[model samples]
Target: MKITFLGTGTSLGIPIIGSKHPVCLSKNSKDKRLRSSILIEKDQKNFLIDCGPDFRYQMLRSNHERLNAIFITHEHQDHIGGLDDVRPINFNMNQPIPIYGLRRVIENLKKRFFYIFSKNKKSNVSKISVYELDDYKNFFIVENYKIFPLLTWHGQLPILGFRIENFAYITDASHIPFQTIQRLKGINILVLNILRKEMKHSFPFMLSETLKITQQICPQKTYLTHISHTFGFHEEIEKQLPKDVYLAYDKLIIYE
Candidate 1:
């Protein structure tokens, strides 16, 4: 299995518009991030996790011709904004792309992209099939992968984190319930989200809290995602992290 970090920044990504923060102003390419997303490929099957606003560019850069499915973590625009851009894939495959998410998230997608869901839709709109996921109680099969949806919380909103075999991906989580943590145990690679070095009321994990959780789960390798410019330059943060953990950057690929 191979995993690609398509985009690693939080919503209003790094180098946020109109800001002059030094990290944002840095010349390093890693510092210039897009909204969070990832691509997982196993045995020629491609599964995308989140399709943020940068999805088009991320796809172009990766140059993958086919997408098997999309697994959404939540309904936030940063995570699902680029979903409409799946038209090219729909055109290539001649079928609607399957999107998996919670019932509420699926409902929100139907409301937000009503044209695509409507019977009177325009020809140009992307076609999608929604598969509602039941937290913990259900699992789905896609090609060679068996996916388990782990439930977590983003403030008051219930969101999903997915576990595929020994690899798991979780993002935008403020509090991961004990049940969810048990589901994550014994993973080979864990991708988690950390917004900054300090805590905020907005509900993303800070570096300190992330570290504590990372220690508890103890995945052989842990990659931090959904970063902000406030986390500091990529190179400096990389040096400070524990050897098994890393700050994910756009286009970074990991194999398991």
Candidate 2:
């Protein structure tokens, strides 16, 4: 299986508009992050996770040709803003793309993109099918691969993280429950969100806190995503991280 880090920055993204921080001012391409999202491909099937605000740009950058499904982590605007862009693929394929997510997420999508779900509203048609998944449910299986959802805390709100094959990607998480940890143990690759170096935000997991979780999960390789500009330059932060842990940058690809 192959995984691509489409975007690794948080909701505000790096270079936060008018900020004068040094990391944001850097000219390096890796420092210019979009938003948090990923692409997973195996066999002939291609799937997307969290089609955020930068979705169109990401697709163009990667020259993506196919999209079979989209799995959402939450209902946050930054996570689902680019959802309607899937319409192009649907039009080309002449079929509705299947989207899987928690019930609240599906409801939010319906409300936010009501026009797409409406049969009478045809201004800009969006051909897509929705599959509402329950927390901790086994969903959308491929041969030899099944996705397991783990309910996690993103501050006070419940969020979801997924494990597929030997790879697990979790983001926007604050605290992972003990029960969820039981399921996440012994994964080959683990990706989790680690925000600022200092913990002051409403979000749950800070840098050190996330690392402790990673140590317990003990994946062969751990990647930290959903980064903020406060994390410092990509090269500088990378030098300080443990050998097995990596700060995921946009467009980075991993195979397992």
Candidate 3:
């Protein structure tokens, strides 16, 4: 299995518009992030996680040739905005891409992108197939792999985190339930989200809280994503992280 960090920045992304943040002004490419997303490849099949607004650019940059499915973490715009960009894939593959998400998320997608689902939809509209996920069930099969959905909390909203074998990916998460923690127990590679350094909000994990969770999960290796410029420069913050934890940058790839 190969996992690629397509984008690792928060909703607004790094260099937030015209902000003067030093991290944003840095010359390092790692400091420049698009939005949060990832590409997972196994058995020659590619699966995408969270097609945020930057999806098109990320795919182009990576030169991706195939995408079998997309697993959504939540209904937030930063996570689902790029669904429309799947048109090219739909055209080339001649099939609607299967997208898995919670019931609310599927409903939101239908409501937000009604044109895509409309009976009178234009020929140019992207094709999509919705798959409602039930958190209470065991892992489900997709292509050549089994996917387990981990129910987690992103503020007051319920979201999903996915577990495939010993690799788990979770983003836009604030609180993870005890049961979800148990599900992640034996993960060898854990991808988590840490929005910033401060803990003023509960919508996203702060650096301190992320560290505590990392210790508890105790994955052989942990990669932090959904980062913001507030977390500081990629190199500087990296120096502060524990040896087993890493700050994920766009395009970073891991193999198992």
Pick the lDDT winner: 3
Which residue pairs overlap in candidate 2's backbone?
A: none
Which lDDT tens digits does candidate 3 get at residues 72-92? 999999999998899999877
What's the count of clashing pairs in each model shown?
0, 0, 0
- Model 1 clashing residue pairs (backbone): none
Score every model by TM-score.
0.97, 0.96, 0.97
lDDT of 2 at 37: 96
- State each model's CA lDDT, in order: 0.91, 0.87, 0.92
Candidate 1: C-alpha lDDT: 0.91
**TM-score of candidate 1 relative to the true fold:** 0.97
Segments in model 1 whose C-alpha atoms lie over 4 Å from true places: none
Runs in model 3 with CA error above 4 Å?
none
